[model samples]
Target: MPALAVFTATAATGTMRPTIATAVAIVLAATSGIAVLWSTRVGAGVGPDRAALGVLAVACAMGAVASGVQAARIHTLAAHPLTELTGGRTGVQLLVTGFDRPIRSGGVMVPVRVEVTGSGTSARAAQLDVVLLARDGWRGLPPGTRVETSVAVLEPRSAGDPPALRALTAPRVTGLPGWTGRAPAAVRERLRQVSGRALKGEAVGLLPSFVLGDEGRIASETREEFRAAGLSHLAAVSGANTTYVVGAVLLAAAAVRVGRRGRIVVAGLALAGFVAVVGPEPAVLRAAGTGAIGLAALGAHRTGRPLAALAAVVLLIALLDPTTATGAGFVLSVSATAALVLVARPVAQRIRRPWMPGPVADALAVCIVAHVATLPVLVASGLGSGPWALPANIAVAPAVPLVTVLGTSAAALGPVWESGAVVLAAACSPALWWLDTVAGVVAGLPGSPAVTPG
Candidate 1:
């Protein structure tokens, strides 16, 4: 991820305006394109090994130049149009840059984070990121929608939130999400409705969040319990979610007698659909990439190197949006996945005994290694977990998959099979009850509060 590091640093420190940045990017691209062509032609004349090495070197150089140009685009916040407003309030138009996370509701007013397209009609669309405290009207709107309003720029309210920009007045919807966004939005809403109708109390709130990442309805108390228990990641759409969905899709495809190549295509489409339904959080994005690699491995009937896949995911994401690297969730997701890929199996193998079976050893390794993998990050960020966190996660681990699969199946059956959906959702009551019991028990334990720095 050296390229990622370079790109992020450059973007964070870039000072060029949009015009200059764009011009530079075009120049870099043209130069790289020419060099790449020249390398291909000249290298063909040399021995095979030398030719391959030459091509690889040219590719790396091109990547570095492209990274610099992208950094220039990311650092657009430093331009005069945005810098001038950083000191005070101003009216501007903003575009929703991502649809990954849901808009957070703080009572009547919601905090909707949208990227800055421009501060005014005359301002260029450099796309500086900011969060807006907007009205109820902003809720349920899909990403890619545009709103115009006045805003007061201020320091970020919290680590997870970006720089706060309070709306002086309610934002007016100037544009709607395109047709491509409508289906995902609709699917999410339908699933939420299905969950509400099929489940009760804790299950109602937990199911959608667990299956779809829609945590809006979760009670504050329940959230605290999950947090203290370190089971919050269960609601973050982990790889387990994708595994269940993809696994089911593959099974169905197989039953229908689809060939290997066709199954891959079907699984890819299904994975995309699942991401849309869950919405795009950093965690969800990570899960999707990992799931894709898992599917590829399955297709080849070979145990591909997972560590390499993880690195590829990191690199691809850096190219797509290096800004994702800044999120705490991203760090935790990548680190934990890497730990599982690299450390979990060995630990499990060492711990395994005749009395302790493979499944138990694997589960123990996952719970322990996940916490260890994320420990440094959490500590450095002044985040912590209770003494009960690890035990609680381990205790609740088995129940998670049960809740996930049933919850997912219920949501999938919602529109077409309402009664069946309700029945399946009702089936989750036992697991939900167990999860709640474990979380409450763990949270109430002495020394369960996350440790804070001295």
Candidate 2:
């Protein structure tokens, strides 16, 4: 476990390097793990063998280091010559990959991931972080759209800034999104239509965000309210959302009298569709992993170790893409998931009273555990203290499952059968109102939930 601390500490803070040091360290880690496994007799303990645990920990450490290095390599901007473009303007072509969240202070800054193909002598292939000043041509472009522009490039002002180059001039999109990109773009447009037709007021803007993770249409005031209520995570498609989707599918299967195996099959199909619709982004993949592991545990009728499951996910993900180690979102996700697995059950038992329903107790436990577990991370990330979060979460806990299940059903049926989608949306409206009400009340309190950074 001490070794795990060493590994995570190094992985979290260490810069990427492609050197003999990394190779040697990885080799040593592998050998140490293998040697431990070999010396300790198989089936040595009634529970898990200590040797196996040691090996797993060591392997995870190596995986973390290797992933970090790989991510550093992909971030070529880390090594780009800032001196070359610091004082002068250059005509650079950028393929828009994704947009970052606009800041809360009413400014339109889109952090875009792009492949740079500069003009003239500067022409070269490299992926760079570019901040697009959202204006006439830059705003509302879906991921995979290509924008080419010429402007001055500036150095990052802060360590936490996402883009390496900030364009001083407006961008003109040179190319439209590819066919593959068109699917997501079309789906988003459909979502906008459905929301506008089925819901009203703030719900119209927030529904797509709640179900599809599209915050492009949310009002700034609504965003602030959600942030203050500590309900901001609902906008993101996470494990909780995945869990609801699978649960809804399973319920449908059961209603049809499907056998256990058939239900599993249905759940799998649903998971695949969900992933496709959500896009195979890192967070979505993580959510999928969490959901799959949860399903596996339930199917086996065994309670697997949550910590081990989390570790395995970290190792596998890091090996696939190292840059995840550096993402604050990833860190928060892992921590919150771990807390759910490790602490939620025990807290549920402790808080359960004779009068309280078991489901209510469990929901409250999860809300409290997740809030407490993520508090340090939130604080470190400058989210500050959200004193009213617990009550707000508890109030809306029941509505989450309803909103997810009914809303997903509506979205699925919307394109197929308009009448059916409307029916489902009608069912979902009450839950949406409940959630919105809770957020509105909690956010209206005297002080901001976000604490001032000292």
Candidate 3:
């Protein structure tokens, strides 16, 4: 709906700030107002489209208000009592809630969240978020690990970022992740080792990232190359990854002559397992939700109106979690999906000629339109998108699908059959090589990372 887009824009632009009750009142008032206007419009020039837009606009406003409330709540939470003490050390027991992949700055920086359990002098418990900066020893800790330590509470780096605390000494590990978290961690580790062995050189580092969304082993140079070329999103798993996974499952089910309902059931289960393994990152979560909506449309035998389905999903998610309206990634995702739905097919048909096959035309059209669609969001977010993005994507486009299919197969087979996993990984080496070459060449071009201000 036009209102959905307008309200989403309003939210993204950071204009509205209503309380929870005010948001509710607005929704009710808007709904009644639209109904009255639509009914009384029989003698006027007002149309159904305009009425529908009014309804959708109210829905979006409601979402924006809710998101503001959520943001305020989070900010208040970050003002924890532990964070108020500046330059003070306190003995606290922490139960690890989440762990970010460690990165090396001046020293190794490990970002994590923990629930502080008071010990020794204090007995209060509170949830705290901080980044641990050290040269080593942080890599061993996983989610659910308990570590006892003393730390100096400091101010947050910026207004939006999480609060900061410094750990001077290595925390004593008291607990490790139980089976819930251990399974995914173990699987990721084995897949990394297997990918390294099967693919040589850069492919070893890049393949796992393409498949499993793990870029820890990739070289800094290569990682920068990807960012410059605007291909970094491919390395981070997203909706496309989920779609390919579910599509593969559906195809296999079809080959076995499975019933429609049975195929849907199998695909749903596969999608859930994939998300769990991938660790529920924001992009992954959004992709999973979009994929689930698509699957539901298929099960209902109403797959023709994918544009409508995508809109519904976007509106619903925005209403439930309003902050998504302001995220560049989420905006890019919606824009990209919209381009595929509306522009890809027509562009494909126009470009299809005697020399090009239909599928090839479609693929090229998708790459071009997706880049074009997300340009505005990129410019707004200051992520340095440029002309290089289109060509780089076109150059390596064909290799991506192959890498995803084969890499996923390798990951699934690794725990069950090491030999099979290696074979699948070896099959993906050529695609990975091509991808690496494209990134290298494109990233080196002058004016590659053009940063246009919004």
TM-score list, all predictions: 0.75, 0.81, 0.79
Task: For candidate 3, report its TM-score.
Answer: 0.79
> How would you encode candidate 1's per-residue C-alpha lDDT over 1-454 as one tens digit per residue?
3444434433433444445545655554565566566565664456445555455555545455545645455454444354556647777777654443333244333334444535545555544565566554556666667778877777644422235676777668888877555655665677777777777888778887788776767776787777777777777777657766786788789999999889879888888877766656455778777656544433343334766686667666656655555456666776777676666777877989999987678667766887888878776765667777778877987777678777877776776778888888888888888998898888888988742211
| Strongest candidate by lDDT | 3
Range of the 10 consecutive residues with the lowest summed lDDT in candidate 1: 102-111
Clashing pairs in 3: none
Better of 1 and 2 by lDDT: 2
Which sections of candidate 3 miss by over 4 Å? 1-57, 60-68, 71-75, 82-99, 102-111, 117-124, 128-135, 149-161, 164-167, 255-257, 280-283, 291-325, 450-454
Q: Which regions in candidate 1 have their CA more than 4 angstroms from the true location?
A: 1-75, 97-124, 156-162, 248-266, 280-283, 294-304, 350-364, 450-454
lDDT of 2: 0.67
lDDT at 428, model 2: 73
In candidate 3, clashing pairs total 0
Query: Whole-model Cα lDDT per candidate?
Result: 0.66, 0.67, 0.68
lDDT of 2 by residue, 1-454 (tens): 4324433634543453444335545665676566566556456556567766676656555644554455455344456543356656676777665533455654356656556656678676666555655434566666676777766666555442333555556677778877555665666667677777788888877777787777777877777788888898889888777777897788789998999999989998999877766655556778888766544533342346656776777765555544554466766777777777766777888999999998778768767886787778888887654678778888888888788877776776776677777777767778888888888888877665642211
Residue 341 lDDT in candidate 3: 69
